[model samples]
Target: MNLFHFSEENGIEVFVPRVKENRKNMPPVVWAIDDVHAFTFYFPRDCPRIVYTRTNEMSDEDHEKFFGLTSSDIIVTVETDWYERIKRTTLYRYKMPSDTFQLFDACAGYYISPQTIIPQEVEPLTDLLNRLMLLNIEVRFTPNLHPLRNAILNSTINDFGMHRFANAKGN
Candidate 1:
């Protein structure tokens, strides 16, 4: 399986294990997302987004509410304010070896490795929205994400990831 670490900065030859300020209690490690969910990182680092997919456990009513009329299996939503920034952003996808990585959060496609990693290659990703469409992901832009976030929190759709939500409008 392919593992990747996405960043806005290029020329990153090595990824050293580092403790994230928000996750200080956890051990230092390099983080990577699996290929299946790499699309979650296809935006600016601080861009707030909500990604989710329908699961068998999700109620039909909840599915209709979030995905009604859409054929996409995956949905990614971002605040409208970040649309221009997302369109202007160019992300680097660093392909990393998975041998030393261990699954940290299966649902979130997060993997961690304590050892420093030298990426196999760095690929530049552009045309963000088109890329998501190519991946069969439905992208939604809303004035505010709070309503969707609250709805998901109360719904039966458990397969969801709200990234950098603290930076979202009105938090």
Candidate 2:
């Protein structure tokens, strides 16, 4: 399986197995976090499909604290270019947050000196873990879509086939 690690400016890091092993019998399922409307795809393959009956009912203060931002403010910017990489890596990106956008620096990064720092904790456990479960499942040895599949939307793709098409189309 492939691994993906992302670090945010706020000392938050997210680690996930980009690709998970797919299995029979118990496939993956998509779960929605009602409060934030964030959806997570999970693989129930051989794992207990626990029924989280608890309501996603969070107080305004709790919700704001969880995300560290207001509802209308920029909580997290899911850039289009960032989704481009995810689409290539995960195949599907059209899941949550309909407000998708493209940014120029999505794939550009430079090291600041030679310093390394360890982080204390990461945010979005519920969001990341839920999405991870889905990513973990639906992974197969061959290129075949399985249950609970995902893809990115409104993102750039530079794959060989796509590149050929773009060259021909001249976009």
Who wins the TM-score comparison?
1
> For model 2, which pairs clash?
41-134, 42-133, 42-134, 80-101, 92-150, 92-151, 92-152, 93-151, 93-152, 94-151
- Give the runs in model 1 whose Cα sits over 4 Å from its true position: none
What C-alpha root-mean-square deviation, in Å, does candidate 2 show against the real structure?
Answer: 19.2
lDDT of 1 by residue, 1-171 (tens): 999999999999999999998899999999999999999999999999999997889899998998888989899999999999999999999999999999999999999999999999999999999999999999999999999999999999999999999999984
User: Per the 3 Å backbone cut-off, how many clashing residue pairs does candidate 2 have?
Assistant: 10
Model 1 TM-score relative to the real fold: 0.97
Check candidate 1 and list the clashing pairs.
none
